[model samples]
Target: MTAKIIDKHCAQDGDLRPQHLPQNSKTRQLNLFEKALVPQNGLFIFSAILLVVYAIAPAAVYLIAPVGESFLLLSLITICAVTSMLLGSQISLFDSRFKPSAPRLAIDRRVFIAVTWLIFIAFVLITFSTAPSIPIWTALRGGATSNELSQERGEFLKGREGAGIALLYISTFLVNTIVPYSIVLLYRVKSSLRHWAAAVFFLFCISFMQKALFLNLILPLLVFLAITRKLSTKIFLPVIFGTVGLLLLTTALSLAGEGGDTSNTRSSDYLTALYAPSNPIDYFIWRAAAVPIFTATDTLVVHSEQFGSRPLMGATSTLISSILGIERINLERFVFEHQFGGWNDTANSNAVFCIDAYVNFGWPGVVIFGLIIGLTFRWFKISTDIGFQSLWLIFAFVLFSAPLIGMLLSNGFAYMLLHGLYIRVDRHGT
Candidate 1:
């Protein structure tokens, strides 16, 4: 049994798939970390299909809009994603080539610590700085208020003008995009208890309330997965109930006291950034479905024409702004924003990517792009052996949850080329 497993994993040229080793193999323990890092073919196909189904939803919505084509599209996409996942599982069973593994080596703890601290500190600072708040003054450091953001959009809260608030948006995107993503990358690589503690402290100091729940508890859930295999829901659920009960009590008491630290408005905090199962998970799931609906159909045009110049500013503004990027408007925005069109966003933002692909390279682009992304994510997941238990699984989750598919598509494209190039060079040198 051991010999057969080894023979199955070993390449003709004597290379070991860094991520995979058969369960009944003596070498299993030798490849622990590597196996964990490789992406899984099953997960890749599953997630990709989910994404595509989501991407094409807008087309579905129109079809099913009032029991129209929208329902048909949604059903089709869901079936496709699920079918692809099942098929990928069968493919992996027969194909040895797909079962590559990641390398296992302990990282330099000191360097890792330094990098992690830098990332955590930068993350805390950036979150606070960019938080939605009243822009007290432009020169002084504070977030732009919902009202000031409206003026910056050019049209008032309830007005319209086509003067193209392009510059304002470009500015907002630059700040919001760069800061949050940079922090995310930083958090990805960092591993330190002190750094985690500091994050908790900073989250506590922030008045927005929900920030603490996410950064302090949920985001760190990845770390728990990474470090331990002893986790069970038996130990998890009680804690959740306790925490919820505590929060509700505190909120009720705070409301009754009235004269408490009312500096931060409770209503705004509750409505704006509050973390609830319904808010993030439902948002992620429905938003996944919403993407295709928003992108492919004219349903959102009513809201877009209404926003006109400065579209996205506050909570309501951001929601509407997201709708603006759906297929038709995003095409206009892409063309307007970049002048030329590219088949970007095809796999990440659901229908946005498909529409972009259709516009740029026709049906060929859509099918090819979808297949490639779906395959790539699956391969990565299989290689890592992430399954549902690994910290890396969250990366896949986050990628799919993104408002746009640009990140996943571009990352896969760049990673494949770079990795392929490295392999070619190594082969030549050897």
Candidate 2:
């Protein structure tokens, strides 16, 4: 008999699914990395999704954003970085050095439950402090302006800057990654506590006031469920409807500008720079797709010219910034400042980590580190018995803001990932 993966959440479903051999099978058995990297593997599929966002999406920079003096150089650097990442991922598949045959630790059921409760309680307390009150709750009742609600819902501690921004990242992980992840884990085991987990998640979403929060919950959870369960294709209709509702919800949040005027288009640096048409659909297209590339490219062009061959090293990192007695604002804030030229505390030109990677170490750093990052993800993935881990979804988005190093060092993702490692979950409703 073939040995199945021994895992924490290694449910019967993961074991039930028949593992198909590669089409070009030979006498030699495929290694764990080879199996994990295959298209049919959920982890591989998740990695592909990340590749599109991190590696492929930057190409939009050339077509969308106007060229700057350093644009050509930055593009070349970006291209090289992407190439390095691609090569690195292939290398991980071909020659992964790790050999995790089983979970390194096993947690008791009672201890796990107690810890889960503690996490939920901490989430509620932290979310309450950050949001204070749900912005949308007041907005829905016409107690506040749409614009004010929109800003508050999006900002989460606009009062703080520099190293205080680390608090914002922590709160974000608690809301975006931790609480929901807890809910998913509890649900997978058919626990009644999942109800409480959902309540905390919704409360956080209401307080935070972004349509994307719900989509974050829905999309990844849906993908996870689809990967583990034999869901019918018909399941997508509700998701489509839910997504359309979310799109409309996003447009609605920004419908009114200042002075209670619903018709006026909101003044946004991105909307103005990208020259998107004054409509809802186009607004989303530009916001979600084009704007990230635009900001990333602008960062590359401006940063290269500003610093020349020298890199910031780790000045961009919050932990390093705190230690070095430097201001801890994200690198995106600097790019936004160069473009808009204000206090610039309220906005940023956020991009995937590679932009900062390039700024910090130039093309060579991006290449060498990109390979290392790919291997870490593959190894983390191969450790789990089940292919679809919820952390994969959260970590993908986290990488958009920071890289593996940044996530582990500063963003609090490391804590959240480590939190789940040994909490043994069961298929028979444990």
Candidate 3:
């Protein structure tokens, strides 16, 4: 009976698998051609190839050309990252025994709903308390820019320490991680409340004017749906277009909210500004994707004289600091301090996994980090066999393993490890 429940929940609603077959017989043996056609496999291959062409190739060019030692280092880091992802994907494909299993803990629907409401209410109350005079409607309508919202948020948290600082951390984690996880789980279970909850949470993130927060929530949800086959292959185009449209819309809203010069800008003007030749798509690409890795590499090169190679130190420090509630060494701030002669909080960025690994242990560190990431993805793939429970796994991986800017250093791997323990304890009653 338990197996039947698991199977039923695991089966995609519109899956083409034959309904009359025994559960064991449902595992279809696919030929090479068919295997290649699987959406997941196709996506993996495409990503691997794209990274080589777009990321690695340019870096390679810079290294070979007169771009100097900085470019060479950047290229090496990029190479490490790309190689790790590819290697990880290949490793995952070969490991078949790591399939997903059903959750041991039963999900109480009522408890879920209650917790979600509590979190949402708390989030709303806190947001309002922080920025009491900022009208939600105006924010939603793009009358409030991201800079304005960020400044207000900074003000609210300014000089806050001790319990206040702790509260800020707790609230940030709950809203960003727990709330999104709950929404995805509820939606997977076909809860009617999910739509309303999701809408409210999305708008709330938008009001903050930070794109990463919104993407952090939605990307994982999309990945969950895709892995579960809940998202139809037929609608892939629509999904892509929809996502792009949403990103553009949100960006326009933020731009419009900047006030003064941008407040009265028309929709066309916003679109033009986004796609302008000088600051074309590449501008966003560089700022959002390439610059962080480059900055990390540059920082390492510049500070080569000051700090000797201490590879495992970076990841270890991150893990220990995270556990002890200490601030992880801010590599970005370090880079900015060196480059501009001072650290600016607003100018913060990430040190992608490769740079993080390389800084601590050099080339070997990069390889190790790559293998771990690859194995993690493979683990997520197998976990899909677990039905609804896989939602959390998918959400966690997608949320943390952000492209060009994620790895084990930032508590993502640690969370996965703790979650694994929870699963084991729940299953075996240890």
Candidate 4:
């Protein structure tokens, strides 16, 4: 009877797989292709997104060479990197060939509350130090949207580059570590703690003045709750729709406010044409699914044209340099110098993990990092039960858009992963 409940709860929902029951003695390990069939595993999600955003779309745009004509050289490498990831998924080191065991934790109420308050206070300090004006609060009270403040936001970030402690808190602590692990704590802790956690979470998000804060923070909660049958369908459906509606409203407002500024049109003919949306539905399809593939691709394109056969030799990453006690080189600024004549927050394009790997190790770097990504996601799946497993999407999102080293060390997902591996989920998957 309990098994039936878990099975029904975990059953097929769109691309996600039903949860695997706890394995008995005779069960066998799943193979590579079999793993791809399990979108619930997260390997599938990460690889599929990378294939499209990093490989396919970039390859298509490269055919046109919208921004940099020379980016075409790296197309084959992108394909190889993605392919290596698939192959890497099959080679399991700490491979859980059997179904994961049940996981549970007992957190003291006092400890949980104390940690939540600590994180909340840290978030408040971050907001005041970095953004004194609190743009999102103003927008809530009938002020200009965050979209209108893009230039000002960029200038604020540029101005703070010299402040070491403030920069670390904003760029490393809040983004990469605290909030994410805190989400894990929310999942595992007792219900009495949730109300306080949620309250703290809301203030922290809005304090940051981001419109997408709700989606990033709450969507994972909903996904996990629905999978565990902790939230009822009626409530889940309504909340999901409302969250999406809010996002759409903010995006539409941005589009409406930014008229007459063909600066968007002039910025990159590549993204403008590649994701050329005639309406909101089309615009959203690109925004939610696809990313700015051209930024990293163009960086590589520019790198190839300028440096040619020379890799950065591990200069692009501060994380790498710090551990090795070497000088850090800023590749984004270097790339920007060639394109826009200077490197600032506005000019520096984000180098996602795979591209950063390529920048550091050239062709071989992609394969090594691809294997690491595949292994990492696989670890996230088998090492934990469904609740922690749900965080796969969040980690995958970080990889899809940001650097890997930052996620592992600076952001604290590595420790979070450790926590999941040790604590795990319930055997019945509730």
Which structure among the candidates has the greatest TM-score?
2
TM-scores, each model vs. reference: 0.42, 0.73, 0.67, 0.72
lDDT digits (tens) for residues 1-430 of candidate 1: 1112112223222122332223444233423332332333336433554555553443444454453443454444444444444444444431333334322232343453355446545644654454444211221233434224323222311122243233233322322222222232233334234344434443432233221223233322322222222123443445446544544432332233122333454332221222121333333443334433444322223223444423222212233336655323443333222211233331112234433333334445445445554554444444322211132333344333232234332223333223322221111232
Clashing residue pairs in candidate 2 are none
Writing each residue's lDDT as its tens digit, candidate 4 over 286-335 gives 56554456567666766777668477767666767777777787667676
- Report the C-alpha lDDT of model 3 over 113-205, residue by residue, as the tens digit: 577678668757775675534433445655566556555544443324555554445545555445665665555455667667777777676
State candidate 2's TM-score.
0.73
Q: Summing lDDT over every window of 10 consecutive residues in candidate 1, give the lowest-scoring window.
A: 1-10
The clash count of every prediction, one per candidate, is 41, 0, 6, 4
lDDT of 4 at 230: 42
Candidate 1 Cα misplacement greater than 4 A, ranges: 1-71, 74-107, 119-228, 236-329, 332-362, 384-392, 399-405, 409-430
- Write the number of the candidate with greater lDDT, choosing between 1 and 3: 3
lDDT of 2 by residue, 5-108 (tens): 11122242323222421223323343443343332353355445545654454444445656443434545555565566556655645222223333435444
Whose lDDT is greatest here?
4
Once fitted onto the true fold, the runs of candidate 3 whose alpha carbons sit more than 4 angstroms away are 1-50, 53-55, 60-66, 81-113, 131-160, 175-177, 228-234, 256-293, 302-312, 315-328, 338-342, 385-413, 420-430
Alpha-carbon local distance difference test for all models:
0.34, 0.53, 0.49, 0.56
